[model samples]
Target: MSLLERLNSDMKQAMKNKEKDKLTTIRMVKASLQNEAIKLGTKELSEETELTILSREVKQRKESLHEFDKAGRQDLVDKLRAELAIVELYLPKQLSEEELSEIVKETISEVGAKSKADMGKVMAAIMPKVKGKADGSLVNKFVQQHLS
Candidate 1:
């Protein structure tokens, strides 16, 4: 099934199982997806668009989790961690550092990137290949290390 369909099915299961936290997270994802669709004046969203939205949601949760961790709020951190886990269920399998490094090396060569000056070209070439599979900050780090 498509990601959206799977999400909808899970949402129904959450409701049936009285899983309040899971239900809330799924509803938030659905709302984000619907908002994006409305913004584009379309009822159907492509899988790529859905993945982008899900990644954004996961990023937000991770940021919040970091803040909560710094503040020593274990309760909030735990909740956000659980939410993050739920959001991640829809994302593609994340790339390991070695895998990401390999891709970055290939992209740099493909773009003929030399030195930090060519970071933009290399990044543009790599983003499409890595999107939804790796985090932007992680990719940026790899690009910077390889280019510099």
Candidate 2:
């Protein structure tokens, strides 16, 4: 099924189950997808574009969680955490640390990345491969660790 169809089905299930948090997140996702379609003058977004949107949504939630934590707002932190969980459901299974390390090493080798100056090239080469499957900050750290 297409991402839109899957989201529509999940929206119905969430409504029936009265899962308010999940329902809200799913609705926002639908709205975002529709907005993108309208912006591009297209009827629907591709699966890859949908995945990008989902990844962005999750990243926003993670950043919000961090900010809430820093501000000592436990309530917002918990809320964002719940929302993040809902957003994560659509993502593929995440890579393990060992797997991430291997990918990073491969990317470095592929890009011939040496020293900190080549960070951008390494990142550009790897992000397409990692994207929704791995955390950006973790990947960045690994890149730095390997490069430095």
Candidate 3:
């Protein structure tokens, strides 16, 4: 099933099971999807678009978790962790390091990125292919190391 359909089904299940945390997270996802659809002047969102939104939500939660860790707020950290787990349920599986490395190498070669100066070009070229599958910063770092 499409991500949105799956999400809708999960939302109903959450409601029926009285899973408060899951329900909240699913509601947030539905709202985010609806907002994006409205912004794009569309009645429905594509699976790729929905994945992008879900990835952004997961990324935001990860950043929040990091900040909570930095500030030594265990309670907030724990909450964010739980929310992150819920958010991650909707994201595609992450790429492994070896897979990412292979892509990075191929991207560098394709873009003819000989030095760090070409990092942006290589990244721009590779991002569309890597989007939602790998972490941006990790990809960038790998690209930089290879190019430099």
Candidate 4:
């Protein structure tokens, strides 16, 4: 099923199950997708575009989770953690560190990226290859290690 169909299905299920937290997360994602569609003047978004929007949603929650944790807001931290888990359910399977490291090394070679100075070229060359499949910071760390 397309993401919208899946979301709608899950939304109905959540309602039936009376899963408030899950229902709220699903609604937020649906809203984000709809807003992006409107912003882009498109009736439907491609799979890649949907993934990008979903990734953005996941990133936002993760950032908030970190901030809440640092501030010692246990209540908010737990809530954001739950929300993040619900959101991540829709993301592509994440890459293992070893797999990510291998890809980064290969990309560095492919881009002839030889030093920290070539970080930009390596990242530009690799991000698309791993987009939606790997976390950006992890990818950057691997790239830095390989490049250095």
- What is the Cα-based lDDT of residue 75 in candidate 3? 98
lDDT of 1 by residue, 1-148 (tens): 8877888999999999999999999999989999999999998999889889999999999999999999999999999998999999889999999999999999999999889999999989999898899999999999999987
Q: What's the best-to-worst order under lDDT? A: 1, 4, 2, 3
Position 50, candidate 1: lDDT? 89
TM-score-based ranking: 4, 1, 3, 2
How well is each residue in 1-148 modelled by candidate 4, as lDDT tens digits? 8998999999999999999999999999999999999999999999999999999999999999899889999999999989989888888899999889889988888888889999999899999999899989989888888877
Please identify which of the two predictions, 2 or 4, would achieve the higher TM-score against the true structure.
4
Best by lDDT: 1
Q: How far is candidate 1 from the true structure (C-alpha RMSD, Å)?
A: 1.0
Weakest ten-residue segment in model 4 by summed lDDT: 105-114
lDDT of 3 by residue, 1-148 (tens): 8777888999999999999989998889889999999999999888789878988998888898899899999999988888888888777788998999999999899888888888889989998888888888999888877887
Can you give the TM-score per candidate against the true fold?
0.96, 0.94, 0.94, 0.98
Window of ten residues with lowest summed lDDT in model 3: 83-92
When summed lDDT is taken over every stretch of 10 residues in candidate 1, the lowest stretch is 1-10
**lDDT (Cα, 0-100) at 131 in candidate 1:** 84
Which scores better on TM-score, 1 or 3?
Answer: 1
Alpha-carbon RMSD, each predicted model: 1.0, 1.2, 1.1, 0.7
Candidate 2 lDDT tens digits, 11-65: 9999999999899988998898899889989997887888888888888888889
